[model samples]
Target: MKRIMLTLILLVGIGGYTTYAQSELSLQECLKYALTNNQQLARIRMEEDMGRFKTSEVRAKALPQVNASGQYTNNIKKQVLAVPGELIQEPGKTVLLEAGTTHNVTASGTLTQTIYDQSVFTGLKAAKAGEEYYSMQSVQSEETVIYNVTQLYYSTLVSREKMIVLDANIEKISKLVNTTGSQVESGLARKIDLDRMRVNLTNYKTQRTQAQNQYLVQLNQLKQQMGMSMAASIDLPHTSFKEIESKAVGALDFGGVNLDNRIEYRLLKKQEELQEFQKKAYKAEYYPSLALSGNYSYNGISNKFDMFKGSGSTASWYSMAAVSLTLKIPIFDGFARRSRVSQASVTLKELNKQKEETALALNTQFENAKLQVQNNLTTIQAQKENVDLANEVYNSTQNNYNLGLANLTDLLDAETSLTEAQNNYNEALLQYKLAELDIIKSNGNLKSLLN
Candidate 1:
């Protein structure tokens, strides 16, 4: 009995875990998941962190730098020096003497501080712009992810809706086929009518199968965009058509919108700022640099290699300290600085042109999104009315055929009209949703999708 209980518990546990892994996601949940799990967004976040470290690295150049160094040498051949012998009362003669020490060691610690360096200071300032550029890039990446995920989410929803419509048509036609079969048996309908009903039923079943396949494909795409496993089964709850229609009732006004509000435009502006900093960094190369440096050093020398021993004829040691100021003035660099500055200036000009072009382009996109939203909303309303009319016609024809007042041909035509109307309505609805997302993105409010 215990073994059976354990087996049941294990099976239950596995089932629960599988269900959790395949849990259904709402649009907001999908967006949130993508932000946290999408590989590209994670990379962008890492890049932002790297940018911060880079800024710190550049800033450190302006701070005091301290370093320690040590050196030891075994002079296998001593260096000889030649001097006139007159100082030792040997006139008109030259003497050669070897320098002392078979072993030597020196250790030093040095500190350097920059007092004035235009180039370093410019680089430090540029670091801030570089950080800002990376931050803007992260924001842009997030917006792009949100846009793409939302698009896939809505597309999957539409495909599911299409499947529902197809299923309904199949069910309705199956009933009609049965009714026609009965009428032919009763000799009230011609055998040809029964044939027509069967053919219509077959077509509806084929369409339904195609729609089901399409829905599965779209669901897989949505899963990929959300960074979920493609094999995971996700169930999306049915969304009411009325709910979608309600969201599109109002016209969007973009007259007060500015290009700067858009993330893409802001990213371009950040790029322009970074380019200006680059130009400044290049021009700073012509300025002189000044620094302060100090060093403390110890030197030891001996005939033997025991420079650190205190027992047997210890080595002599001496300490020295010095502080100095260094000034480097750029006199000429074979026109290298001139060429770099010119190149930087040209790049700055190019960025300015790109900024202008981007602004114009953003404005155009905003206007077009606004127009598309309005047009698609109108289209949705018209298609909704058409679908309603088609549905009513199908119902009336079905009733008439049951009463032997209408032929199977009339019923099949009504079914086709209804199917076409539903498909058109769903397509228009999808377009309106996409247009709404565009407007939101153009207004720099794509983040609102999370809400």
Candidate 2:
């Protein structure tokens, strides 16, 4: 029986340790896992690959293409015609003349090249620009992912911290209940004191339970974002004033939204440039297309059915080469070219307006994030003071209650005030973090934070 009891105690201790360990995950591990294993990142990378392939496909038009062909013909009868009367110098007798049909088999190999094509050149350039756009978009997508990961990381961190706080509170209340129970058993303290301690202990247990639930939920959320298994658990480290102090919030040194370096800005600029190119591309159709084409062929003509004829009967082979210039001028297309150029011009103007709007929006968001961080820094200090003051008041109230100078109701009020202050301080810290993250993202610099 003693051995079984000992085994039961060991099992309980192991279970408790496991539950304790599941409460936290480190920030670095979370970020690393998130960036390296995320499905969204993979999808964006695939898009980048697709863009690259499209550019390659466009460029391939400049390369040479080779082809081989063969033809066979058989004529069952020869063609016959009447002799011309002018050749005979008389209209009297007409004679039938037969031009024998020839049986022939021919094979040829040819190569065609696009030496210069205005539309192909324009398309290749546009494809290159498109590749650049998608590449930058991938970078921006990565930055967005990193920002989300940071927010979730901090949220999980705060939840775990709250859980720790609640557990400590529960432990303190349990100790109080034990003390009150002893006093009541000895008939010194009233049974009402014991009941009150028990009630407070229950409330602490409820709060602790809620905190644990939040912690687990946040952990699961982080795991999901990191592309880990749903059953995977994470353990995060504790954060303290020392940790916060160790990190520095640097100065905001934005060069005022460089239109060229910013990805979204550059993408818009490229779109406008591409539209301008498209206007010219469409105009290429209005200009006549000129191509110089040449073909060299060898043909063998035979009146006999046999392809390999002896020298007595003749098999003649002819070689020919010709170069010709072909020109196609479009005189009418029902205003298609005119309408396309107009549409392109309109689109370019719209992109120009969109760029201006984006620049303004970005500047506004940047300034707002900076001001928010600065303002919240001040509020954080005040919230810290509030928490300190509430803690002191609660401690004093407890002391006064032990001395019979303060009532249970007063202690309860002090506890409530302290709890609210703590929650407010926690929320302030989270808000400050979110504000800082906003600045990090607006600057397009999330890689340093996550990777």
Candidate 3:
């Protein structure tokens, strides 16, 4: 019996844990989760790392480069050297003697160091700029992810609230249908009225099903934006209509949005910076470069395989060394460097144009977002009042219908009005939230959402 009780207790504990695991997630939690798990953001981070490695590679050019080489040869047929016979005291005759050893081995090491290379220096600077460019891109990508996730999160919340409203309407109308049927049986209500109530109840149920399905679809989309698994069961916390209205009403103004705050504008500026570096790099090609090279080698020659043993004078080994400094003057290249510099200057001008355009566009976005925020705030207030009035009318009509002072049609109409008002109010809140998110992004404060 004790074992049975223990098993029951363990089962209950597991069930509770499962329920807790699937509990509702708030907006902050969702944003934080996306930042950590988003696949796109992860790729951007890897690209940033690639930029750093690229810079390292360019810097490596300035360091001394060393290499080793070895070769072994076994001559099958040595070439004969023909000499004048008179020189060997044999008149009017030619003599032939074989040249070179049967076996030969050589090993060498070399080092090359750049003393003054204009191109390598330019490349190092360009690489550093590229790394910074990638870093900015990463930040921009994160902001985009945060904006998308926040938008989807609130959209899902709105859909869920609509579904809730429909469910409540169904429940209320179902009760009305039951009451009307009893009235018709007792001769207090006509059969037509009972049938009408049943039809309305059926319609509400159908509408509720659609609303619930839409809510489910939206929830799945929210999970997708959050980088959560499709197979995972998750819930979103419910936000009341009144709370939404209050939040919208209290929307803060981010006065005088700075173009520098917006990541898009900053990215453009960073591009301009990189283009300037590129222009300098192209111009750097006109300059000369100097390098120092050193080499050391060991040669071994023998008629037998005894070079490593160094046995007697039959096998011989010698060491050779050389050092030289080379200067490469860019005398001419068919005016290629001049043409490249001209193109870079043109590109810089284009980038300057882009920066100007981006600045104007960013300003326009901020202004439009602020305008929308104001408009949504007004709509939310009006809708909030409409909802309250509709609820009052619904309650009064419902009570009157119960007392036979109102017809089923009037009650149904009032319920419809209430449902519309509630949905409109929720829609206004969603628009306001979206506009607020835009304001935050335009002000370069999307990361504030995580806080």
Candidate 4:
């Protein structure tokens, strides 16, 4: 019984360790997990596989097709044919003759091969191009998933940082409240001043509570983006602000941004190719198609149901074979073919326009992302300075209040400014990170995050 208890304890310990390990994920690991487990990415991969099968299906149309068939019949009532008796030396008399047998059987096989079919060839090409299109589409989807997961990961981190700041402020204000309460008890401070300290402490706690709630919500959102179960407990290990700032600074020195390197542009080019292929398929309808077909058959007849049982005089068997070449020349079909060609041409023209529009849009987005990143970087610097100055002012005001050189009101105002400055700096940092991600995405380097 002691051994059994020991085993149970060991198993429980291992299970707890495994759960702990699963809950700890870094940003890169999170992106990797999402790429492998995301439902949308999996669906797109399946669509790409289906495209390959569809291409094979189209290719099968050009291959030889073979079929076999069999049939049997039993004559319930035999029919009779009228004949002239004079033909059998009977004068001016007619005779009736029974025709057909009581049983019949037939088996046949046919084979067809396409010699020349413009439509089939065109369709094969189009299907192949379609496969390429889906492959590009999958790449685009993966890039998008990476972008979303990275954004959510950073947002969750920022929320947690804000909560940390709020907690620190609450601790600081709680200490002040204690000191002022003692001062009031000794009649060295006004009751109203002590009341003000209690109110400030209360506000700080409230803000901390709100910040904690927001952090939890953002973390849950991040988990959802990573395709993780929300019920599972997870922790994001803290990252230093210095590290983040250094990374952002490094990103500002990127090489020339190329719109053509972007996945969106590549996807658009693939779409255009697919549309061109479609137009070719439509035009191929005007051409003729040629094929070769052959068939072989065996027949049996008998007066009884013994056609396959015996080769007796009452049963007979015969065979037949034939081969032919068939050519289908397209004839007039109420201008349907012409209308299809016109429609396909119009679609191709539209696709070309769309491609141009996408190129321009991508160019604009890249430029805008660059501008935002630079502007946010500047804002981050300014906010950092503001936070430093606010901290200095708050420290000086606290010292003055303690020496009776400043009022309670001035101390509270300085504290408020410090809290606001810190919050704004954190927010600016978050925006800077977001803008940097956007620039990476626009430059078609979002996949670098996985590394």
Candidate 5:
């Protein structure tokens, strides 16, 4: 008997551990992990980084760049000549350019300052504009990150909640089976009642198993997407969808309202501005440019490659500076510049269209979300009544069975009905939670709430 009791206690412990492993996870932690660690977010952030560097690159072009150069020459043979009279006497003969070991070396520093350059200026400005555009895109990406995290988090919550409902039903059905077994042993119920109970219990068990599997799968997926470590376990918090569902069913604080706060809307606006910048830059391409540049050098020549020994060499230094003006008259280029302007203009028009289309789509989505939440809330209200009614019916039938007024069949039917109604209530609660989350997401408020 002690051995049997020990075995039972171990089984219970195992069951408890399993239940705890499937516990509720916190929303805040999930969102944090997902935003910071998700691979998609990381990739998008890399793009944003590239944009930042590009912006710096654009700015760098406007600054002066200094350069240095050096040169060395060695003569295999030193040409000899009398300073002047000997060179005149030897005019018929080949006269060398230098005497003794001849060496030529030059080192210089040059600076080019762009006083003005139409193309560079325009390109720099465009690069800056591009960076701003990418930064705006990152904003949109952040919204996307928020959206994806909420979706997976809430979706997993829903699945786990659904599994809880199934598990409850399974428990209730198991109890019914036990009750029927008792009745059969007492010869008060037919064997068929026990068989029916077994079948119902088996069905509920199957459903519970499926729900459990789905819950685990969703949990794993959420964990992986959030870049959670395998060693860390997910524990979801138990949340009731009742009040949220009720609110969703009614008109929200923002019914038939526009969410200009949406990233997509703002992104489209930025795109329009970007197009304008491009058009302006294209226009600026026709302007002229001016720049200033100068260089200085030091040279020492000798038979040796010494830096300081240069007595035998003619060492002289010269410097030059110039101001330049460039005129890009845009004489003709097959109308390519005009074509680019047209392209930019066309893009602006397309962005306008895109803005319109996105607004419409968002409106449709919010409307649908509103309707779903309201409908689910209505369902919850009705399911609540059904649960109460089923509970009453089960109680009455069980009382009758105990008093020998109703048979096992009636009691079993009542039990099954009550179980189903309870499960339906659970489903209604979860639907309400999900619907509310959807509304928030549609309004572009997921970031504010989750992150």
Candidate 6:
């Protein structure tokens, strides 16, 4: 019984340790985990594999193809042929003879090698380019996942920080409530003052509860983005706001935004390349094709159903073989090739238009991100000053109330203003961080977060 109890205790301890280890995840670790486990990203990887297989299939078309086949037949009702009596040396008489054999077996093998086919060659190129396009698409998908997970992590961190601030405020208010209650009982403070303090304490506690709930909601969302179970518990370090600000301050130093750096632009360019190949493939349809082919077959015929073991004198067997070079000239196809070529041409034109549109959109996003980063930085600086001023005012008010030079109402109001300023600063910090991420992304540096 003691051994059993010890075993149970050990199991619980191990489970706790495992959960704690999993909960201690940094931003980079979370991004890495999501890349490995995300369902959407997994699907994109599967498609990338499919693309490779498709390329192999296209390449196979250019190689020689060999096939073998076999067949067994019973001519249950052979066709009869009418023969002229004179031809058979029987004048004025006709003869009817059965054609073919009662039993037949045949086996054959064939080989076809493509010598030259413009369309096939062009298709192979297109398939290779298509594979490259899928690869680029997979990279684009990874970038997207990284961006989402990072944003959620920052948001959840800010929410948690806000809850921390609320808890601190609640603790301060609770202490003040106790002090005021003691003063009221000893006749050093009024009943009204104590009652007002209690009211403020209640309000702070309520706010703390709301902030806690919001933090949990944001944490759940972060978990979802990381492809983590909703029921899992996670612990993010209390990363100082100053640390985040310091890291983000130099985000713009990544320099100029080049359209080539953006994955979306790169993917579109790859698609355009594939489309060019498609146009060539359609045009190639008008060209002729050449191929080398060979066939070999053996046939056995017997009146008895004994193709495998028939006596040599009772069964007849024959073999046939042939080799040829085939060249096909496309004379006409009722203008089909011409129409398809025109369609491919038009599609290429549309792709070019899309490229132009994408270029414009990319530039717009970069400009917007730059503008937002500048604006958010300015806001953060201003809010930081506000927080400092509020803190100073609260401290002075508290001192005045302690010396009996200020009313309880004034002190409580000062505290409220200070809390408001702190929250505003936190919100500004969040905006700044989000804008910083945008700037990094616009500069095509999201992959840097992986480090």
- Least accurate 10 contiguous residues by lDDT in model 5: 1-10
The reply for model 1, stretches above 4 Å from the true place, is: 1-24, 82-96, 182-192, 247-255
Tell me the tens digit of each residue's lDDT in model 2 across 280-347: 78977776665555666666667776666666646676666666666766899899899999998889
Task: Write down the TM-score of every candidate.
Answer: 0.90, 0.79, 0.91, 0.90, 0.80, 0.91
lDDT of each: 0.80, 0.71, 0.82, 0.80, 0.69, 0.81
Better of 2 and 4 by lDDT: 4
- Candidate 4 residue spans exceeding 4 A from truth: 1-24, 78-99, 244-251, 311-314
Cα shift from native, residue 128, model 6 (Å):
0.7
Better of 3 and 5 by TM-score: 3
Which run of 10 residues does model 2 get worst, by summed lDDT? 1-10
Report residue 389 deviation for candidate 6 (angstroms): 1.1
After superposition, candidate 5 runs with Cα above 4 Å error: 1-26, 75-102, 245-251, 302-307, 310-330, 403-413
Off by over 4 Å in 2: 1-29, 71-104, 190-193, 241-261, 296-322
Candidate 1 lDDT over 260-368, as tens digits, reads 7787778877877777788787778888899999999999999887887776756899999999999999999899989988998888788889878888887788789
RMSD of each: 5.8, 8.0, 5.9, 5.9, 7.5, 5.7
Worst 10 residues of 3 by lDDT: 1-10
In terms of TM-score, which candidate is stronger, 1 or 5? 1
How far does residue 400 in candidate 3 sit from its true spot (Å)? Answer: 2.9
Task: Give the higher-TM-score candidate: 2 or 3.
Answer: 3
Best by lDDT: 3
Worst 10 residues of 4 by lDDT: 1-10
Tens digits of lDDT, candidate 6, 1-451? 0000001112332331223232345678778878876778889999999999999999999999999999999989999999988988998888898999999889999999999999899989899899998899889999999999888887877777777778878888888888988988899889998888888888888888888888778877766776666556665545567764554455545377888989988988888898889888878988899999999999999888877774544668999999999999998899988898888888888888998998898788878877777777777777888889999999999999999999988999999998898888888878877877888888889999988
Candidate 3 on 285-357: residue-level lDDT in tens? 7888899999999999999888777445578889999999999888889999889889988988998898888
